[model samples]
Target: MSYLDPETSKKLVPIGRFMGEHFTGGNWTELGFLTGCDSIVQNHPRLLRSLSFGDDDYPEACLAVVGSMVRNDPDNLKLIEDYIIEHFSESGPNISTIPGLGPTIRFSPTVFKVPTHPQDAKLVAVMMPFGPSFAGVYEAIKSACSQTQWFYAQRADDIWKDTTIIQDVFDLIFRSQIVVCDYTGRNPNVFYEAGIAHTLGKTVIPITQNSADVPSDVMHHRYLTYLNNGEGLNHLTLTLAQRLRTLDPTLAQFA
Candidate 1:
C-alpha cells in the first residue's frame, strides 16, 4: 500500500533493512520517500546518505530514523517491497512460503505481493528424517494440510535446487512460516533441522512417536505423539489440521 498504518509499519521496519541490503546493487538513496515522508527525508538527507553508503552494520540511529519515515507515510513501502519480491523471485521464487502478519509469526504480508503462492496457501515446512519408515507419517501431515484448505505441507526431499541438500533445507526453513519437526526416530538430522527452524523464529510444531525420543534440552516445547499405524495416523491428521488452522488464521476459513 502507498500508505500503511502503525501496526503494519511496526512489522515492516525490521525487515526493511534486510530488503534494502539484499536487493542486489540497490542503494537506499534511490528509495522513494512516502507521501508524508518527503519533508523528513528532505530535512535530513544525511540519514538516507548514510544508509546508502554506510557499512553493512548500519547505525541504529539511522535505522530508527528510517523506521520513523516508514511510520510517517510509507508511500514507497510498496515500491521497495516489490523490488524485494522481484529480486527474491528471480528464479521462479526464492521465497517459497506465503508472507503474513501477527505476533506469533515472521512477516507482515499486508502490502507485499509475495508471488510463490498467489493462491495464498501458507506453506508448512516439515523437518523429518528422510527414510521410508516415516513415509506414512509424512502422508498424514499432507492430509492434514488438505483439511485446512489453504495450508500445504512440504518436506526438504519434496524440492531440490542445490546439490548440497543442507542448503535446500536451509532455504525451505527460511521461507516457511511454520515448521513441523518430527523426532520419531530421534534422528540426528531431524534434531539438527529442528534447531535451525527454532533459531529462525519460525513457529515450530514438534511431533514424535515416543516422548522419550525427544531431546532433554527441548522438552519444554509441547509435542504431538502419534503411532505410525493406520488408526494412529488417522488421528494424527485431525490433530495436525486443527493445529495448522490455528497457526495461520488469515486463510483459515475453516477456523
Candidate 2:
C-alpha cells in the first residue's frame, strides 16, 4: 500500500484532495486514501522515470494488481474505474483541479520548447488535414487568422515512421496557443486530438460540417456549423473571423 516515496506522495497530495472534494461526495477519509493512491500511481518518480525510459514493468505490475482486484471483486472494480474515469480520464488529473496545488505541471510525454521567434511561432493549430472536403475550411481559417500560423498533421514529412504520427501531433498541439478541431465525418482522430487540447487547458474551437458529428459530452459548448460549399465557406470565414476577434481582439487586425 505504501509504494511511493515522500516527495512523490507530497506531489500527489493535492490531486487526492481535489478528487476527494469533487468526486468523493465529501468523504474526507476516502479523499486521503485516494490521494495516497494517486501518489503511488501518478507521482511515483520511479514509475514515471521508467515510463519515460520506455520501461513497462512498473505499469504492467500496477495493471496486474488492478486485474487481480477486478477478478476478486467486480463491484469494487467498477467503483474504482468510475472514480478514476470521472476525474482522471483523458490526460489524467492535474494541479488545475486543486486550487492551491501550485502551478500546473505538464505531463505530456514529449516536452518541447515554444518557438522563440515571434513570427515562427504558431498561434492556432487546425487539426483537420488538407483534404478536398476540408480544404476550403482550412483556407478560410488561414484567411481569417492571417497573423496566426496554422498547422496540419499531414503537413509533417514522412521521415519518421507512421508510428510517430501521434507523437508528432502531440508536439504540435503542445507548442500551439489554440487548437481548431473539425469533427467532420465523425473522425475519431480529430476527437482524440480535441480531447488532448481540452485536457491541456488550451482554447479549442470546435467546428463541424454536421451537428451530428459533435460528441454528446461536448455538445453544450459552442461550435461552428458550416456547409462544405462555396457559400458555406464564405459564411464560415466571416463567422470564425468574428469569433477570433471576440476571443482575442488582436486577431481582428489580421481578419
Candidate 3:
C-alpha cells in the first residue's frame, strides 16, 4: 500500500521534484520516510499533537501505516531508523519486533541544547555586496523598515576576517528570519547564499535591477523587479516593506 493517498501524493510531487533536483546525493528512501512522517503530521494533526506530547503509542501506530509502504525495502527501514536517530541527537527511537508483524518503531523524546543569541538582534539579513550601484537600494530598504526596528545588514559590513567568509555567510543565513537577496549582475556568491537560505527554510526575498538577472530555476518564486534609479528604488522599498508586513504583522504599526 502507498504511504500517501493519490491526492496527498500529487500534492507532494513538487516537493519531491525540488528535493531530487537539488539534493542529488540524498537517499530517496530516507526522503520518502521523512515525507511520510510529514504527511501524517499535516493530515492527522491530532495524532501528531499526541506524538509531540510524548505519547508512547501514537508513533507506533503511525509507523505501522508508514511501514506498509516500505516494508519490502529493508535498506530503507534501516535508513529511516538511522535518520530518526541522527536527527534526534543519536538517542534512537524505541524499537521492537513482533512475530509475523515485523518491527515496530516508537517515538522517544530527546533533549538537545540550542545556543542562544543576543536579544533584539537583527532578524533580516541582506545578501548583497556593498557597491555604488547597490547603495540606493540598501538605503531605501532601511528607510522603509525604520519603524519596525528591524536591523538591516549586509555580510561585508558585519563579518570579521578571523572567521571564514563562507562559514559566516552560512551562520548569517541560519540565524536570520528572512534573507533579502539582490541578484543584480547575477552574482555567483549571492546565488550560492540564496540556495543555502532556501535549503535552511528561511524566507528569501529575491530582488533585482534587471529581470533577466533572476535565474530560470528560481524565476517561479516571486521577486521584486526595479530599475537602477531613484524612482525604482522608492517603489522597491515600499513593496518590500509591504511584503515584510505580510510576514510580520507587528511591522504594520511601522507603516
Task: Report the candidate with higher TM-score, 1 versus 3.
Answer: 1
Better of 1 and 2 by TM-score: 1
Q: Please give, for residues 1-255, the per-residue lDDT of candidate 2 as tens digits.
A: 223333333434444444333432233234325434433344434444544465545444344333333333333332453455445555433212111334445463444333232211245667874467677788887776753323322222322433566766665565566678888888888888888778766778899898999999999999999998999988888887667664452232233
The C-alpha TM-scores of every prediction are: 0.56, 0.49, 0.52
Identify the leading candidate in terms of TM-score.
1
State the displacement of the C-alpha of residue 166, model 3, in Å, after optimal TM-score superposition. 1.7
Cα error, candidate 3, residue 190 (Å): 0.5
> TM-score of model 1 relative to the true fold?
0.56
Arranged by TM-score with the best first, the candidates are 1, 3, 2
Sort by lDDT, top down from the best: 1, 3, 2
Q: What stretches of model 1 exceed 4 Å from their correct place?
A: 1-121, 251-255
Best by lDDT: 1
- List per-candidate RMSD values in Å: 10.2, 16.9, 14.4
Error of 3 at 33 (Å): 34
**What is the Cα-based TM-score of model 2?**
0.49
Tens-place lDDT digits, model 3, residues 114-233: 213321225677888668878888887776566355545555467653345676666566567678999999999999888867755567889998889999999999999887788988
